[model samples]
Target: MEIVRGRSVLKRTAVGRLQYYEKEEPSVVRRQVEDTERELSRYERALEQAEKELEALYERALGEAGADSAAVFMGHRMLLKDEEYRNSVTRAITGERVNAAFAVETVGDELCRLFLEMEDEYLRARAADIRDVSDRLLRILEEEEKGGGRCGRGPALSEPVILAARDLAPSETVLLDKKKILGFVTEQGSANSHTAILARTMEIPALVSVPVAREWDGRLAAIDGEEGILYVDPDPETLERLKEKKARQEEAARLLLEIRDLPDVTRDGTRVELYANIGGPEDVEAVLGSRGAGVGLFRSEFLYLEKETYPTEDELFSAYRQTAERMGGREVVIRTLDIGADKTADYFGIEKEANPAMGFRALRICLKRPEIFHTQLRAIYRASAYGKVSVMFPMVASLWEVEEAKAMALQVREELEREGIPMGHVDLGIMIETPAAAILSGELAEKVDFFSIGTNDLTQYTLAADRQNDRLDDFYDPRHPAVLRLIAYVAENAQKAGIRAGICGELAADPSLTEVFLKMGIRELSVSPSFLLPLRKRIREICLEETENDQGV
Candidate 1:
C-alpha cells in the first residue's frame, strides 16, 4: 500500500478504483506563412469555433451543476473575447508572418506567464484559465487542419473511480461525468483554483498537491478528505475502515438536510436570522439550496473586478435584479464597491500605498469618486422594485463617511424619481469593521437602518494585525475580548436604535463561538451557504436560558 498526503479542499471520504486522467496536448510548430491575411482568417475561424464550444459547455454546466460552477465557463468566454488578447494574437500572426497556430501558442504562453507573475491570488488563478482557453483554440485549429470532425471526447468510465490528474482546468472538471467520478486527487492546484471551487460546489471529496502517479491507475484506493490522505492499494482493513467513514459522512449529511427547512432558533425559543454571503448573482442558487433566509452580504465589487472597465448602471441593474428575483423577496444587502486594498482592478488606477489594508479602500474610494458610487446606488434602488433590497457601505470609520454615502444614495433615489423610474424602499446600512466605527456605534446607529460587524477586518484592525499574514495567526484572535466587546457594543447600539445588528464575516461561521455571539445580542449570522445547516443545528442545541441562569441574570 502507498500513502500520500495533500491539502484537502472538502471534508468527505471516498473509496474507489484509482484512474489516471490523461489529456492529449495539441502540438504547434512555428512556420513561415506567405498569406498573413489567411492566417488571421484561420485564427478568427478557430476562435469562433472555440467560442461556440465554450457556450455549449456553459449550458451543460448550468444544467448539470449550479449557476456558481457554470459561471466559470462564462468567465472563460469573456477572457476569450477580451480585446487585448485578440489584438495580441493578431499582432503576432500579422507582424511575424507566422502560422495561426504558432502565433496563438506564443501569445498564449506570454499571457499565461504574465498572469502567473501577478501578485494577486485572483489574478494568478487566471493563469490556469488563460491556458485552458488557449488549449481550446489550439485543439480547434488542429482538428480543422487534420480535416477531421471534432472528437467526441469524454473520460471512458466503466465504473465509479477516484480520478487522479496532474491538474485540472475548469472546463476539464466540468465536462467530467460527475456520477462516474467518486473523488479527485490532483498533483498540482490550490484551494482557490476553479477546479477546487467546482469540486466544493459539487460536494465531492478533493485533494490537491498529491504526488499521484500513473502506476496507481486501476488500483483500489481510499480517500480520506478530512485528513487529505490518499491510500493507494489499501489493505483490506483500511478499505473497510474508509467505507465505514464514508457511511458516517453520508449519514451526517442526511441529518443536516433534515433540518434544512427548520427555523434557526434556540431551545429557549430565541430566533436568529441565518443568511448567506455571496460574491455574485451565480451564488444565489447555492444560498437557496442551503435554505438561507436572505443574503447578508452581496459583495458588489465582483462586477467591477470581473470587467476590464467600470460596469454600467444597466449592467449592474441586471445582476442585482437577477439575484433579487431569484431570492424570492428575501432581503439582499448589497455592499457597494468594496474594492481597493486586497481586491483591485487595474482600470481603477489605484496607486500603491505603504499600508493598503487601512489605506484608500472600500467607501473611501466611493466618496472620492461619487460618480462610481452614484451609478451603483441607482442600480440597487432600481432593482429594489423586484424584491427586498438594501445597501450597505464598507470601511465606515467616521460619521461623515456614512453621511456622505447616504447623501449619494438619496441623490440617486431623487434622480430616479425625477426620471420617472420606478423603485422600492431601500434601507441604508454600514459595516462596523473599523475600531473607530465600533467605538462610535451609538451615534452611527442613528444614521443607518442596520449594522453588520465585519469581524474579519474588525479583528485585524482592533488587534493591529494583518488578517492575510499567516505569521500573524497567533496574534490575530477573533475571539479576543477586545474584538468581542466591539461586536457586543455594536449589537447593543443597534438594539437601542431599534435596528438589527448581524455578523457577516468569517467569525460568523465559527460554531465554537455560537453561544458567545447569542449572549452578545447578535441574533443574525451570515456565512457561506455550506455552513447554514450545521450552524442551524448548533443554534437549535443551545438554550440561552441556561447561560443566563449561570450568569445570575
Candidate 2:
C-alpha cells in the first residue's frame, strides 16, 4: 500500500464502494426480516454456547492461575454485557438482513450513508458503532465455523494505547482502562461527544474527526490532544522533539499540582472565585480534589440521561444533598434539566423536532413535564437547607418563561411546606443563552435573582453558525463584537439590578477572555478546575480601578 497520508480528524470513517443503495422491494423486506430472525436465533444460540465456554475457560484459568486470571476472564464477561454493543446487534437484526457475505458490507454501506447525512458530528459518527458490532459478530461467526469455538483471550492491555476508531461509543469509552489508554484518535467526534467529555475528564490526550485515518495503518504518529493536533509519520528527530515536549508537559502538570493549594493571586491584590462545572455527584470528588471554590454549574441533565425513568424526588434530593455537602459552605448553582428537542428523554417520549436547539429544551421541557420539573425543584429546595444552592433555568427566552418557572418553583416550595417537608429558599437565576434573553436582559434581571451568560449557545445563535460544523467553526467566535455586546448588556443589566452576574460557559475558562470578562463587570467566573489558578492569577494582576478606567478604550 502506498503511504498516502493526510492531516485529518482522527474519527472520520472511510467510505468504500459498497452496494447498499440497491432498491429494496416489499418482498425483499419480508425475506430480509425472515432471514434476520433466523440469523438472530442462530447468534443467540452461539452466544449461549460462547458464554458456557467462557465460564469453563474462567474456571480452568482460575484453577491454574488463581483469582488474578479469573479477574481478567470476568472483565471480558463485563465487556460482553455492554448495552451499546448489544443494542447495535439488536438494531442490525431488526432493521435489515442478508447472507453473511453481504450482511457486513451492506451494514457498512448503510452506516456510511447515515453518517454522511447527519448534521451533528457526534451522531454522524455513530456509524462506527455499526461497523464495530458487525466486525465482532463476523469474527465470532468465523471462529465458530472454524471450530475455534470462541477465542477466550482478553484484549492486549497496554499503557497508553492510542485508541483509533471511526468514533467511540459511550460504552467503549467508559469501559476502557482510562489509565492505560494514553490518548484517543478517532475518525470522527466533536468536543461535546461522550468520548471527548470522558477523555477530557480523565485528562487523556485525544484527537478526533481525522478524515480517512484508517488508511494511515501502522504509520508512526504523534498527537497532542491538549492542542488538538496530530503529527503523521514523524522522523526520528520529530519523535525526539515530541518526547521533549511530553517531558515539558509532565513537568508543567507536576508544577501546576504543587501550586494548586495556594490561593490564586497575581502581582496585584484582586481575588476571583474559581469554581468547577460538574456533570454528576461523582464529579464532586474531582472538584474537591482540585480545591474548587464551589460548584459553579451542576449539569442536572446527567441524572436524566443516565436513568431509564425520571429521577424520583428522594433520588434527586440525595444527589443534590451529596453535592451540597461536598461543597460544604461554597455556592453550588444547579442548572435545571436542559433537555429539549434534540436531547429527548426516552421515558418522557419528547417528540423530535426539525430544529431542536431553538425548540422546547431546558426550561421549556420543564414547562411541558411539570411533574418532572416539580420533582427537581423540590429537590433543589430541600438541598438548599444543607448548603448554598442556587437554581438556574437554562435557555430562558422570554419573561413569561422565567415567570412561569419561578411560579412553579414557588408552587413546589408551597407543596413541600404543606406536606411539612423541610426545604429552604434558593436564589433563582436565568442563563442568558439566546439573543432574545440577552436583548431583554434588563427585563429578565427584574424577574431573576442572577444571570449566567452561556457563551456557547450565545455565540452559535449570534453568529448563525452551528458550532459543531467544521466549515462554520470560523464563525464560532466568542470574541465577536456581537457576542461581546450581549455579554456587556447582560453584565450591565445585572449591575443595574444589583445582583451578581457570572459566566459558566466555555468562554469563562478561556484565559484570553478573563480580563475582558472582568472589564465587563462580571462578578464571578466559573471555569473548569484546570483553569482555576491561571484565571485567579489573571484576576489578581488587574487593579479594579485600572480595569474600570480602561473600559472606554
Candidate 3:
C-alpha cells in the first residue's frame, strides 16, 4: 500500500475508489481589442453574471451546508463587486486595450500572488477566493462568447468516490453533489481554506496537501482523516485491516445512535439538559437526527451575513419560526445578531478595527443600532408564538448592556402588542462570554432568565489571546484553571440566583470535562448537533461524585 500524508480538516474515515476531479481551467489569452468601450461593457456584464451565479450558489450552499459555510459565497459576491478590483480590471481593459478575460486573469493572478505572500494564514487562504472569483468571471466571459451554456466539468462519477483534486475552490466544492462525493483529497490547499471549511461543515473525511497521482484515479483507497493518511491501492492485508477499523468505527457510531432517544443522565441518576447549537434553520435536521433536547445557541448573525441587505422582520421571523416549529416545542434560544470579529457583512459598513474581537461587536453594535436590534427583536417575538423561543444578547459584559438590550426588547414587544401582532412569552438571556460578565454573573443572572456561558470567547477574552491566531495555539488554553474557575463561578452564581446556566462553545462539547461541569451544577450543555449523542454517551458513563475526587472540584 502506498501511503499519502497531509493535513486533515475533518476527523472522519472513508473507503472508496479514487476519482480525480479534472476542473476546467479558463484560458485567458491576451488579445488586443480595438473597441475599449465594448470590452469594458463585456467585463461589466461578466461581473454582473458572476455575481448572480454566486448569489444562486450562496442560496444552494445555505440549503446544503448551512449559513456558516454558505457565507463564503457572499464573500465571493463582495469580491466580485469590489470597486478596487473592478477598477484594476477596467484599467487593463481600457488602458492596455486587452480582452476582458485576459485583463481579469492578469489582475486576479496579481491579487492572488499578493494575498499568498501575506504574513497571516487567514489572509493567505483568501488567495483561493481571488482565484475562484477570477476563474468565475473568465468562465462567464468565455460562455458569453460561445452564446450561453453551463461551463466547467460537472460531476464525472455516477457513484460516490474519494474525490482527488489539485485544490478545490469554494464554488466548485459547493456545486458538486455532496452525496455522490464520499470524501476529498487535495494536493494543494491549506487547513483554513474555504474548501476545508466546507468539508468540516459537511463532516466528511478531507485531507489537503497530499501529492496525488492521476494514475491512481480508479484505485481503491481508504482515507483516515484523523490521521491525515490515504492508503492508495491498499494490499489485501491492509484492506482487511482498514475494513476492520471501519467496522469498529461504524459500531461506535451505532452505539451513539442507540442512545439518541435516551436521557442526558449520569450512572448515579444526576441529569442535565443537552442541546445543540445551530447557525440557521437548515441545521434543524441535524438537531432532530441527533434528538437534541433543544437549541441552546441559535446564532442569529448568520441570517444577516448571508444576505446582500439587512433582512426584513418577515425574513427573520420566517427563519426563526421554521427552526422553532421543527424543534417541535423544544426551546430554541436565538442569540441576537452577534456580528463583528470573524463574522461580518459588507452592508454593515463596519470600520476596520485594530482588534475587532474585543471591540465594537455583538451587543455593542446592537445597542448602538437599535433599528437593527428592534427589527430582530420584533421578528423573534413574533416567532415565539409558534414555539418555545428565547432571545439572548451576546458579548454582554456589564449590567447596563443587558439592561439596555432588555429595554429595547421590551419596547419591541410593546410595539408588536399595540400593532395587534400575535406573540408568545420569550425568555430573555445573555451570553457571559467576557470575563467581566462571568465575574458579575450573579447580578446578571438576576436580570435574565438564563445564562449561556460562551466558553469559546470567554476563554480567549480571559486569556487575552486571539483564538484565530495559530501562532498563539500553545498560549491559548480553554481548560486553563482560570477559565474553569470562571465557568464554575458563573454556574455557582447562576445557581444562587435560581437561574439556568449552560455552556455553548467548544468547551461544552469536550467529553473530558463533562463530569466537572456536572459537579459544578451546570444545568445544560450545548454543542454542535453531531456531538450530541457522543456527549450523551460520555455523560451517561460519568458519576459526578466520583469526578470530584479526581478533579478537585
Candidates' C-alpha lDDT: 0.86, 0.66, 0.86
TM-score of each: 0.82, 0.74, 0.86
Candidate 2 wrongly placed segments (more than 4 Å): 1-194, 209-221, 224-243, 530-553
Q: Could you give candidate 2's per-residue lDDT for residues 1-553 as a string of tens digits?
A: 2222322322222211111111111111213546677677656654565456545654553333222223333334433444544555556666655433244445555656776687765345445545444444455555665776424332234444555566664434545564555565666566655456555544656666665355454455667544555666666775687677787777766766665687754345556667888766766766777778898888787667545578898999899999898788788999998875335455666664545677767888789878889889989999998989999999988999999999999898898889997766689999999999999999889998899889989998898876655555456788899999899999999999998898998889777777778778886887765566656555656666675666664
CA deviation > 4 Å runs, candidate 3: 1-5, 17-24, 110-125, 146-155, 158-160, 176-180, 187-193, 209-220, 232-236, 417-422, 462-485, 545-553
Task: Give the per-residue lDDT of model 1 (tens digit) for 270-379.
Answer: 99999998878887988999889999999888777667689999999999999999999999999998887657676787885656787889999999988898889999
> Which candidate should be chosen as best, given TM-score against the real structure?
3
Query: Candidate 2: how many backbone clashes?
Result: 18
Return the clash pairs for model 1, or none: none
Backbone clash count, each prediction separately: 0, 18, 0
Residue-wise C-alpha lDDT for candidate 3, range 16-64, written one tens digit per residue: 9999987877777889999999999999899878878888888877776
Error of 1 at 505 (Å): 4.0
- Residue 222 of model 1: what lDDT? 87
Instruction: Candidate 1: list runs displaced more than 4 Å.
Output: 55-75, 115-126, 148-156, 278-290, 299-329, 338-365, 395-399, 417-422, 432-446, 453-498, 506-513, 528-530, 546-553
